[model samples]
Target: MAKALIKYALTALLLCTGLAGAQAQESGSSAARKAVPKIQDGWLDVRAGEGQGRLPIHVSRDWSQAQPAVRRALIVVHGITRDDLLAGERAAAKVPSAADDAIIITPQFLIAEDVAAHQLPELTLRWGVDDWKAGFKAQAPAPLSAYAVMDAIFARLLDRQLFPNLQSIVLAGHSAGGQYLQRYALFGQGSALVDQAGVRLRYVVANPSSYAYANDLRPLAAGGFAAADASQCERVDRWPYSLSANLPAYARKPLDPAALMRRYLAHDVIYLLGEEDKDPHHPQLDKSCAGEAQGDSRLQRGRYYFAYAAQFPRDAAFKQRLFIVPGVAHNSTRMFGSSCGLAALFDEGRCTTEVAAP
Candidate 1:
């Protein structure tokens, strides 16, 4: 009988140990949700995904307290520089008067070396090359795509507990950041998740180098749009340009021109262009054959794209506008902070096509 008791005691102890370890792992996973530095004014505690996880989005110090008072979530994405923390800070400071209780978030997509160089905390996700820009899988140890990061963020924000009363979610980006949103708006699989969240969603694309066209039609140099000379540039309708073929992995499915067009038109989108950003041969300007197929200059392309979408007959409910911010060049700071920027964001600032050039 003593021998039997000893064996039973040993078995109980092993079971307890196993349970304790499982509980600890569960706690650790929960604790790993976010890591916030001691600093203020940026970097929130909203985190998702796994393995070398991405940075927690930046936010105002009072974000928690402000959640209850918030009505809008202004998600400002960074450009090719991947300096979203800084971008978020600057963009948040430019809030329109109408967005009295809006919350601003900036998702920081980093490079592997950037963390070590800047001494950032460990487990900070970083993409190799420009993979993140295309919503490609993140660097090894974490297979999360850039688009998935945004998806997780939207889900978290829509949580009844985190933000109980959000009325609008604005996904806005400039330059490379603009390119990300433009594609995500068309191909992000999370659109259904966002749509069901019962909040109004907005997409503001500011001064992107190019756009994803629904058809193979390319804008002409002399006048209207037309099909590209297939023999000359057969790859004209490729990914990131015209949804022709070879879509990136993050592209949820094959680009269905008609479906994409309907989805894009149904969403609330605004193309905010910088009027003075008209340098046809600007060094940073996309000189790629695809870009040239759009227009000669950023200003021209924005105007042309807007016209194209406006003329699309499939979706009669297409309600998109292209607003040119006066006197602003290729600067997001001035572009977003201008009175015109305020209007695009909060629906209450002065913006008109007719303005004296700055």
Candidate 2:
């Protein structure tokens, strides 16, 4: 009876310890979630038709006056954390050239909890936790697409009075931000604004979870492309995955596939893939059927997408380059701070342009 009692008491103590540890972990996570900032440093006025809203952004310099020395602009987008300030600053610091030659702007997309936590004004735009990453319409104030915020910023940048010497614009993002830019590059009207202003535009997509396919074709495990089995996942060809009719209001009408493909190919896009980011079961990696249809890992998805784009007939202006960053994972700072990242931004460093043989 004494031995039985001792065993039972020891088991009870172990269970109690486990339960306490779980509760402590849960409490710590809740505290960390609550610690995220409610807003950014500056406000960007975005007005589309009758819908007017304010976006929180971090501008490296005061745009009110003319920045004649500014020859390049770097618009860096943050990942899921919405920490734009740190992202923008870190990217700018990676450039080894003249510091004042470029202006950096980073925009933050807030959520309902953020507005509620800080009691922000109603006109301050907000979206669902991860919806903004896909150009979803904002929840409060006016129904505005998050891409429209980028449009407004682009329009402001086109002003010669503010940035008279601005020659090129490097729109870059990492992870979720890369996903946003990859989709926005196809549908967003901001690129047209840059073209009209006669400013060179470049997009640097780094380590996104997935890519937007122009067709039903997906990468095969062995080596080639094949149409996805719709019987397995019905929504394989949906928006944000492939070009479909079910697009956000920002995209407006359904685009012609051929034209869209041609336009995207003609645009200069630099893809950066991390060599060490090959974990198939990464917690933050997109595990949906659509994502898996692309590849098993971020690195594979990037390689597959680059090869897929090569199959298309690009115009004379085609300028797409892909670089594999050695010894890096799904880290924003390390990926963007590498030689390839600096070359993609400042056109100075020597980045490896070709992938190694398997």
Candidate 3:
């Protein structure tokens, strides 16, 4: 009788204890679900005194969340005087890397009134026509260059405390933005820092008005190239065309032409051009005497640049490749959404320039 009573009491005690533990587990899950902060997608108040007191960078909501297991980043820059369009890029990057968590960033460069109204410090970089694209130092107050802004951006990302598991970053631009990418890829000083930290970076230049030529000569209409005669376009052989003439104070270190060209050719870069951006009379086209020296339209300029690079230094093994988005004009949406664009933005899908223009 004593043994039977002891066995029955032990069985009842175990059942009650298990029931209480189950209730506690359910309560813990409920508390965990409530702990996640409610997030709304918008801009970030970049706490820095560099530009405009505090830079207002448009960021994707996903960036607020943890980087998905894939660990990738895509930074999309807007064209000159364009409204905030980072939300678009965020969606585009997401489309291709559905399985991967990619954080998309679009840093605003020219915030004029916002800074003025707020009485914030003047730190944003600006230039005439396309001078900023060449990466010159700001004239007054702060001596930072547009390329310096890119450096600061990477510094924030490379902070292991912030993005501990980041693997790769893609820097891309369209139109004037593309112009920035091409030059920065070749000569930007900040890239070495990221490389040292063991993070990979790729440049995607899309539909820019021109390319930085290694020499003073420009391509002719009848299938050949020649030097820019002083009597013709005097400034053609300077800065953007060739590393000649007096550059801004920012380029304190004189770069050897031969060494610079070789270094540029070695980086991983993609030249993405749109087939339908062939209008010679586009309102925003670079029609200065120097721009005309390159080619008549965006398409012509890109083709000539690629051809020039390919035949340089006795046909050096080039790492740069040119891609064209079919039937796409000077439109950002179509360019990034195309198969070629998707391939550049994300490491998935095949890209080609053989498609016919629609």
Candidate 4:
């Protein structure tokens, strides 16, 4: 009986040891899978206020082989419901792999399934009509705003001490991403963090759903309106409209066209619109915002904003440019890859086109 008991005990000990080995192996594998190359690609935690979350950042640079001063860094922001990894892959594929001096950083956002689930206060506050915070009190969590996430990413880049030879930083975004950057530029003015960075910030806004306010509508001269007639002056309201209602009562009441121009002039702002995106029935169209005051279509909205900017005091110095690319529609990869689309943002000579109100 003693011999049999000893045999059973030995077998049980061996079984336990085998299970322990398997668990250790599995844990090691998981760590290996998450461990990306620290040189070009890796994940870093971005501090959003006090909370922290991992933001995956992909970096590409080859300054060791190229002229130091020629090095340029670009941060690519993706649209809603889209992943930055996919966007970065598409962008990197289109550009020649031989371009060594440019460093592209595509940072991913913490967006989940529900759209309204993560509604940012900084954004909703712009549209005063809806108190989304109060209405969805239970759903509201201390989440990061689009701008906050951007700020965190920039801070992390500086902390990483990477891209030592970087000279310029371009903030490029498409569709909803463009919308976020537009507001970010306006809100970030004179902030100590951005001002001290010594980084030349330029914006490439591609086919955003909405745009900042230009100014109060002005009636075109009779000759100018002849083509469209009195209907041209008729007010139309549209979806994804400006946050006019949210403007503080004590704030600058009148919409100043010159001020708008001055804000845009501070940065290199370029708008790349898809010619095929003129469709009013496009699936992504924000019909409600477009239909409000001067409401017609996305094409018309773009024209109006462009014309209004032209009326600025420094209109000549701050000459605005817009690109209407053929055979593209509301897709960042398509817009950025097209000859006219990406060229419009990079090339000053080829990108410049007169903004004439239609």
Indicate which candidate wins on TM-score: 2
For model 3, residues 202-283, the per-residue Cα lDDT tens digits are: 8888888767777775666666566665444545656665666655444547777657667777777777888999997675
**How does each model score on lDDT?**
0.66, 0.77, 0.63, 0.46
Arranged by lDDT, best first: 2, 1, 3, 4
Q: Over the stretch 2-90, how does candidate 4's per-residue lDDT look in tens digits?
A: 44544333332232232332232111223222322221244544344434444445656432344454345567766544343455445
- Go through the candidates in order and give the clash count of each: 3, 0, 0, 16
Which ten-residue region of model 2 has the weakest summed lDDT?
20-29
Candidate 4 lDDT for residue 110: 35
Show pairs that collide, candidate 1: 43-58, 43-59, 44-57
1 against 2, candidate with superior TM-score? 2
Q: Model 1: per-residue lDDT, tens digit, 17-62?
A: 3232222211122222233222222442324344336464666435
- Whose TM-score is higher: candidate 1's or candidate 3's? 1
In candidate 3, which residue ranges exceed 4 Å CA deviation? 1-54, 61-70, 87-100, 111-129, 139-141, 314-316, 354-358
What local lDDT score does residue 82 receive in model 1, on the 0 to 100 scale? 57
In model 2, the Cα lDDT at residue 105 comes to 86
Q: Lowest-lDDT window of 10 residues in candidate 4?
A: 127-136
- Poorest 10 consecutive residues by lDDT, candidate 1: 24-33
For each candidate, give its TM-score against the true structure: 0.79, 0.87, 0.77, 0.62
Total clashes in model 2, counting residue pairs 3 or more apart in sequence or in different chains: 0
Output candidate 3 Cα RMSD. 26.0
lDDT of 1 at 155: 76
lDDT of 1 at 335: 75
